[model samples]
Target: LRADIYPTLESPSATDWADRMALPVASIMWTPVASVTPDTDIRRVAQVLLDTRLPGLPVVDDNGLLTGFVSRTDILRAVANDPPLDVWG
Candidate 1:
């Protein structure tokens, strides 16, 4: 939905907040949005993000409600924080 929201986010000239707010949510929202579960593998999550070309994805529960978000930066940070393996040892 980020792409859908992007067009309405900024304009060439100043925009009226009231006008933007009045627009129907359906008109601006994307359909069939993808999401992942809490138990989803990190590798699968990475693949989904790459395929969707999104900065992040929603983390949903079994009931299909959003619990949190997982982002590219979050994955990168996890990798960066891990101690490097002693391959030569």
Candidate 2:
């Protein structure tokens, strides 16, 4: 299960630990299915993250296969570099 859903499992609504362990992973997973291409500009990636309220997104290739994952930290690092990546650059 995703860490994002951890709090929900601790709430009163959730069953006890033993019962939760028996449940399926699919029920609590955060599967936004959002992704970006390797060459997609940083601006677009930031926009998608904001729209989905997700911490990160999967990076896919032209064949629709997972290549890597991009998180908000990655974007921040890019912008904070000595020569920050510009929207046009």
Candidate 3:
């Protein structure tokens, strides 16, 4: 199937290069994105990371505020030096 592949924080590797060549570009593509607010719960944020496979999510607060962003690395740090918890659930 043809689809747009956006690069994440990490650099694209050889596998990614191969995929880009193998797949054809689709005429139209729609990807649903999930955003988080400042008040959003950490559990939910972790869930989003697992579900979306996105490196990060934009953090938009209520009152139309743009506070900052959150990434997988940020979550890793939160879990201390140990491995991150199972976010799959």
Candidate 4:
């Protein structure tokens, strides 16, 4: 999760803050970013999300177009509504 989501104190101290403000955002963002294509396998995409610990992944097309996005919550909701799998010994 992004650190910005947390609430800050009204009079927060900056003594503990790092000197990272001068760095460009691109330098701090994750590299070789993971993404899913329109035709990407659902199972593979889910696994990637689980492995990367990212809330969601950008959905791109073969032409490198940003079509949409998918998130862990979306997958969980889908699985919750789908029929359960049957198993037998």
| lDDT leader | 2
Model 1 ranges off by over 4 Å: 1-11, 16-21, 83-89
Model 4, range 1-89, lDDT digits (tens) per residue?
32532235344345423444456778667777788998888788889998987889999988778899999987877676675534451
Give candidate 4's whole-model lDDT.
0.73
List candidate 3 stretches off by more than 4 Å. 1-32, 81-89
RMSD of each: 4.1, 5.2, 8.8, 5.9
**Per-residue accuracy of model 2 over 1-89 as CA lDDT, tens digit each:** 23464565445344666575687989866566888999999999999989988888899999989999999999899877847666675
Candidate 1 C-alpha lDDT tens digits along 1-89: 43345555554233555665679988766578799999999879989989988899999999999999999997777666666545576
Error of 1 at 32 (Å): 1.6
TM-score of each candidate structure, all chains considered together: 0.69, 0.69, 0.53, 0.67
Local error of candidate 1 at residue 5 (angstroms): 3.6
Model 2 per-residue lDDT at 15 = 60
Candidate number with the higher lDDT (2 or 3):
2
C-alpha lDDT values of all predictions: 0.79, 0.81, 0.71, 0.73
* Candidate 4 pairs with clashing backbones: none
Of 1 and 3, the candidate ranking higher by TM-score: 1
Candidate 1: deviation at residue 54, Å? 1.1
| Poorest 10 consecutive residues by lDDT, candidate 3 | 1-10
Candidate with the larger lDDT of 2 and 4: 2
The pairs that clash in candidate 1 are none
